[model samples]
Target: MYSIDETYKNIEAEFKPRSKWDQGVKETALAVLDSLDMPETVLPDHFGSRRALLLNGADNWREYSYGGCALVYNVDIAARFFTPSEMRRYMADGHDASMAFRGEPLLDLQARALSQAERVISRYAREH
Candidate 1:
């Protein structure tokens, strides 16, 4: 149960201004990945490196290139508990109409995502 103010403070620290040439997407994205605990089977290219669980619609997952940008979210082990929309809705407090604009860095959102993942994984573990 984190207050918005505390979350904002974290966002402030995470989103430090970058030089004109450095837009902080991939690095932040990889940092987010570094925070997760995934199996080695997900992607060999990212194995043992990218750590955090990724739920996009945030600055950590946005990639800008070729005159466009994309946001990314993933659900593999916990995919059965909820659809991406449902999970994101839980993250967003019900409504997701503005999910794409929730540009908080991973530092702000990682704890919540990790807690949610724990719940989902616990359920799967118990049932299976």
Candidate 2:
């Protein structure tokens, strides 16, 4: 099982940005992730639990949000985990509710990411 800091560092080191703007975010996110202490668990296949896993042991707000987005996308990459219709509904409800707050776009994005986190949790609940 990977420690949070180790996983975070690994993830950061692995981040190959497509643009210069993302460099700062990637670096900052890695730093924040490094500072956290998270439980070792299977990565989520759904959105909700994925976000929760990302938020686990997060010390800073930005780290919490970034992790959520990263984890959600991780699930997204699986493709087979969620149907398009389910993903669409999940994203719509999640994004609107999450993005409603007044804050940086990152926070809004994090909120959107969290909206889908529920699916991950639901899947986990059934599996266990």
Candidate 3:
């Protein structure tokens, strides 16, 4: 299994940042990855699948969602604040929330993302 640092480096090399928000998210993602303790044990399946999704997006620039933002958010949050089981639960809940609105009201998605960001930021702050 690849270490989280190795996985993150691979991701950074593969996904070019296009905007300030994109660049911030990428940098934050790497910071979150670096903060992980048992990075080798976390998100084995999810990380691989998400990385593949990102690679696909990189190969086809027209595909928007696969570009790693949501994947980064999910993995970062899971690594920082959740157990494997809770990670699955919250991720499914977030997906369900998004689907219930037919992707409109994007507030649900934004809330989920913001919650993840807040948690990761707070944890990083407390640790450092």
Predictions: Cα RMSD each: 16.9, 12.9, 13.6
Model 3 clash pairs are: none
Question: How does candidate 3 fare on TM-score?
Answer: 0.34
lDDT of each: 0.32, 0.43, 0.43
Please identify model 1 stretches exceeding 4 Å from their true place.
1-105
| Top-TM-score structure, candidate number | 3
**Per-model TM-score on C-alpha atoms:** 0.21, 0.34, 0.34
lDDT by residue for model 3 (76-99), tens: 434443445654664674465233
* Model 1 Cα lDDT, one tens digit per residue, 1-128: 22223322343445443531122332333333334334232422231222222332222322221112222342221232334665566456564443332464323243344334333322222211
Better of 1 and 3 by lDDT: 3
State model 3's lDDT: 0.43
Query: Tens digits of per-residue lDDT for model 2 on 6-123?
Result: 4554555555656433443454455434433443544455545444555665544456556553433423322323345644654664455333223434344444333333222233
**Worst ten-residue run, lDDT, model 1?**
62-71
Candidate 3 regions exceeding 4 Å error are 46-128
